[model samples]
Target: MKPGTLHLIPSPIGSNTDVLAPYIRSILESVPYIIAENEKTVRRFLATQMSSELLAAKQFAILDEHTPFQDMPALLDPILAGQDGAIISEAGLPCVADPGSALVQLAHSHHIPVMPHPGPSAIFQTLMASGLNGQRFMFEGYLPIQEQERLARLRFLESLSSREQMSILWIETPYRVKSLFASLCRALREDTSLTIGQALMTEESFIYTATVGDWKKGAIELKKSPAVFAIQALPVAAGLRSNKSGGKAVGKPKK
Candidate 1:
């Protein structure tokens, strides 16, 4: 039998897979073994696209942070044996910011075919709704948790965004969302365009983009919600004018 492919499946970020492509569903149906960040989550996702019988028959291997690195090599045994296998995350694409990237790297080192299926990503979804500089943006993932270091990091990212005319995107743990927002409000200039997307792709989702001054007028309580924050780069003069007139700062032109 030919060497089986290692499919990098993109699971839904939210509770439902309504945003996933039809082909992604078909790919999941074809794979019998899945290397998941969390077996329960992957199983739940599979249940949505498959029959209960097929779901029960599917084999799973967990690959979260707690999993030992040395054990990763063994996870690919099924794929190496010519059995098509998949790598999935609790939400979104397995490795963009998840642990599944390690497996993908291993697959490449072994000359195994790796396939990526397009699906919904909270990062992209947040950018889409953020109305920021989507054409020239960087995903910084999570920021420093230490107060002083985090403040310094935020300043650096803000300055980088301003200088490069690029949007700086980052995330924080659910419980720390409010604190991060507060830090952003404190550290960023009044003119900088700040955006926050909460519970994206869901009914309770909220996305708002405005100047830092605007955000301060009446900041929404983030509570313990999953959120993504972005800062749009703007020219100094334009940003000043927007701050004065209560208007949006001009974002970088998509060229």
Candidate 2:
């Protein structure tokens, strides 16, 4: 049996082809089959760009959270039997916040080889630029999208940022970004600094690092650029605000 390989291709966040050129060509020439989150978007992007290399008479299958579990046995059987395939997420790196965990677990259970091709990922990009503490950080992924769940998660993240002294990373739906930032303004330690990165490594990008108090006073307008954010943990200063209040801390740290 031929040894099969599973490649994780990390597509760009926004529409940028040049950044992904080398990887695209490699996949088209090498892999016989491809799995993707949105087959239509991939087709549309190839068509719009008039790229014959990646989408020229190529066949693809849609894969997502709803991908039937029963089909895994048959689908992955070929790979175990040894036919190489590539998996592409909607954006960023696969298996991060993306829904490739189950497929990966399947591969592991059967001892199939899974290889990754490193590329741009929003989570790491934000961390690199956020000026937050990358040494000890937590990637919280997307908080609950619904109001109650979102707030609950936000409250927990807020406490972690203040008390734990760790960088908190998060992403929200583009449209809800303004409101999410507003809530953070109401739920974080004062003097606690946050770095917000929007569209990292792409056109129309922006990054801001500032305190929660400055944010509440309209110092920064989040509406202009929606983004992934990192709130760096602060030192245990002398004037610590009540963890529940999440307001500004009033003084410097004790020596």
**How high is the CA lDDT of each candidate model?**
0.81, 0.70
TM-score of 2: 0.83
Residue 33 Cα positional deviation in candidate 2, in Å, after optimal superposition: 0.6
Residue by residue across 106-173, what tens digits does model 1's lDDT show? 88988789988888787888889887887899999899887788889888888888788999898777
lDDT, candidate 2, 69-138, per-residue tens: 7766566765666778778778888888887878888887877789888777888888887677788899
The regions of model 2 sitting more than 4 angstroms off are 21-24, 44-57, 224-226, 238-255
lDDT of 2 at 75: 62
